[model samples]
Target: MTMPGRTRTKVCGLTNADDVAAAVDAGADALGFIVDVPVDTPREISPERAATLVGAVPPFVSTVLVTMAPIESIPALHERVGTDAVQVHGDVDVGAIDRLAGDCDAALVKTVDAAKPESARAYADAADALLVDSTDESGAGGTGRTHDWTATHDLAASLDVPVILAGGLTPANVAEAVGAVDPYAVDVASGVESEGGVKDHDAVRAFVSNAAGASADGAEVSA
Candidate 1:
């Protein structure tokens, strides 16, 4: 299959409808909602709240339910939110992922820590896509820090599935990350937030713009 030529942007960890609107208005291709994650973060919201916000999203723009819930609980959480995709973090069950694949229609994205890119191999065949994230003491994601881009680059090149790069990405550095990894997509949460749950709209716009510029730069080089 041919991969998408452009580097897509996903603005995540939005807690309210207004923040959701801000991200969409900023031209984010996808918006993520953290729902009932085991880790404590201000971004985590009820499945019902995620559902309400997800439902409010306009068509053509994707909504993602980001969580670390048990594999068995995913179907219910996904059902409640009815998101277009699900980003699963932390320790995940491969067999359960396979089962969840059969149970739900949302595309499954398995997140792997950048420190352990090899761990991604197990899910490369299972998930529709893979997300490479920077993990910290807090949890799988929500780390306002960057990881080794060299590792992420190599992993993205080797993976058969589309790779989404995440962690410590801000408008200032996302272009550089995009240029380095050439990922299929880039995801950000804390990077674009004014506080924990509020979005910095200007930062959101710059992030998306820089990602696009990076894609254009790559295309120019390839040509």
Candidate 2:
């Protein structure tokens, strides 16, 4: 968990070794690999590939498996990737999420659409952490659009699990978003990518540096 006033960062949609190294060098607390997503996305990679990248991650820098929300196959993917966490984005079933958490070694992070705020709390019972993201037309995340930070702030305050704010988060506005939401962490995919599935090294560094200093409580980011 993010201590006191510190806000962590997760850089998502990593598909290659360069991107993974870029995120790690940029000081990202967690790295997300999009594996077997139900919908079409340029960032998606095979579980075999995910394993290779995940295996190469240095200690303490978490590797997270990102995929659509369906509990049935998550355990298998989680096992194959050897990630530290599994972040699922979609209309999640609480019972299913609980089972996934119990079945897998990796932690579970569930994304809650800001449009449907009611579901966030229920996930707290099963999820290790909760993520707030702006959903796309298909009701899935990776919208590259910002949602109401005020609502997200309220949601975070009301939940027991750590809340990771994501969606359209860029270096230009991450400080403000951190100030507004005071989230436990911030996650970005497109905002740090030069193009889909490609990490913009400069952007990644700028984002990490910005988010690390943007704590609303006037404290340095936790180690």
Candidate 3:
């Protein structure tokens, strides 16, 4: 678990060994790999590739497989991906998460749509952490759009579980997001990427630095 007043950082959509290394070197506390996602998404990686990339992850730096696959397929995916955690996105229900919890050993991080704060508390209880993201037209994350920070702030304050703020966060706005939401962690995919799965190392560093600095300063940001 993350310590209070310290905001953790996760860099998602990593595809190769180089990207994984860059994310870790840039001070990413967690790394996310998109698996079994929509055909149109450039972030999607095969379970074989994910396993290899996840193997390179060092201790204390978590490896997360972000999947939208059905609950029944989770066991097979988890075994193949071999990650420390799994984040379920898209229109999944709490019962699916509950079933996943029983079958998988990896920690669960449930992504809640930014518009649905009312369902947060229930989702929080079912997963290790709750991630708030701006969903795309397909109802999946990585849309590169920001959500209502005020609602996110309220939800985070109310939940006992950690709230990881994600969606359209960049080095420029991470500080403000941290200040406004006061999340336990922040997740960035397109924000740190030069392209779909290609990460910009400098942007990764700046993002981690800014998030840490903002947490320490505790300067409230404008909505």
Candidate 2's C-alpha runs over 4 A off are: 1-3, 217-223
Q: Mind giving the per-residue lDDT tens digits that candidate 1 earns over 32-109?
A: 999877777899888888889988999999999998887888888898889999988878777878888998899999
Worst 10 residues of 3 by lDDT: 214-223
Model 1: per-residue Cα lDDT at residue 14:
89
Residue ranges of candidate 3 with Cα displaced over 4 Å: 1-3, 220-223
Please estimate how well model 3 matches the true structure, expressed as its whole-model Cα lDDT. Answer: 0.87
Give the Cα error of residue 154 in candidate 3, in Å: 0.6
lDDT for model 1 comes to 0.85
Tell me which residue pairs clash in candidate 3: none
Local accuracy of candidate 3 as per-residue lDDT tens digits, 88-173? 98777788889889999999999988887877777878999999999876668998999998889888888889899998899999
Worst 10 residues of 2 by lDDT: 214-223
- Report, for every candidate in turn, its global Cα lDDT versus the true structure: 0.85, 0.87, 0.87
Q: Give one digit per residue, the lDDT tens place, for model 2 in 1-223.
A: 2337558899999999988998999899999988877788888899999999999999999989998846798898788889999998877679988888788888888888887888887788889998889887565788889999888888888777899999899999998999888899999999988888898999999999999988775444556
**Candidate 2 at residue 98, lDDT?**
84
